[model samples]
Target: LPSAGSSRFAAAVTQHAPAFKGTAVVNGEFKELSLDDFKGKYLVLFFYPLDFTFVCPTEIVAFSNKANEFRDVNCEVVAVSVDSHFSHLAWINTPRKSGGLGKMNIPVLSDLTKQISRDYGVLLEGPGIALR
Candidate 1:
């Protein structure tokens, strides 16, 4: 992957994906994940502003519901948010009726420090939030 500061990235609309590493909630457990973990596999990664909000749960569940389809094509679906791991766990534990993304099969990473959002160039500096 090209470095975030590389000229290629500056000139190209779609540069190499930024690298990230952090803790994530997976099947009710916390796990560590990094870009390297998906080195040999195709990944469908999504970054949402936060959890338990309007539209976010729907998107998360949508991707999660079709997890099998991605696996069939050798791809892994992963999500990231600025919320903490604890928040992720709670949301997943809650049911869809409560507007929570319950029991997702994919990894939902926490970018509590916002480093991942910054590296991905999706961080809204002024608001200290990530744009989906």
Candidate 2:
């Protein structure tokens, strides 16, 4: 048995690190993905507020620019938000010239149910979104 606090903490960790199941934007396609997909690789899982927003693109682009660095270290960056795969693709298709992500090598996951956001403890409950 565990203390109330300890139990809550364990539950929280289990939720985030558990087997994640969803479709990810990969190589210009939305396909099924899960934590097991990254089992043999170092993963830099990050969460952002949403797509097409200020401050978010800055971080996304910055990560994009350094994507090779992570890859060099044998690590893959997987960014997530409460947006749909279509939204992620749209943002990727839009050009930086028009305030959108352009040609990013990393995959952006869609957590439309907000389950991932909540599990990661990055969700802005007030607005029912993530905080980035």
lDDT of each: 0.85, 0.79
Candidate 1, superposed: residue stretches over 4 Å from native: 5-15
Worst 10 residues of 1 by lDDT: 5-14
What value does the lDDT take at residue 4 in candidate 1? Answer: 74
How does each model score on TM-score? 0.88, 0.84
Candidate 1 total steric clashes: 0
Give the per-residue Cα lDDT of candidate 1 at 107: 97
- The candidate that achieves the highest TM-score relative to the unseen native structure: 1
Cα-based lDDT at residue 19, candidate 2: 53
Q: lDDT tens string, model 1, 38-119?
A: 9888888788998889789998899999999999999999998899999999999999998888789899999999888777
lDDT of 2 by residue, 1-132 (tens): 233223122223334454567777887788888878887787777889889997799898888788899989888898899999999999999999898988888888999987767665577778978776
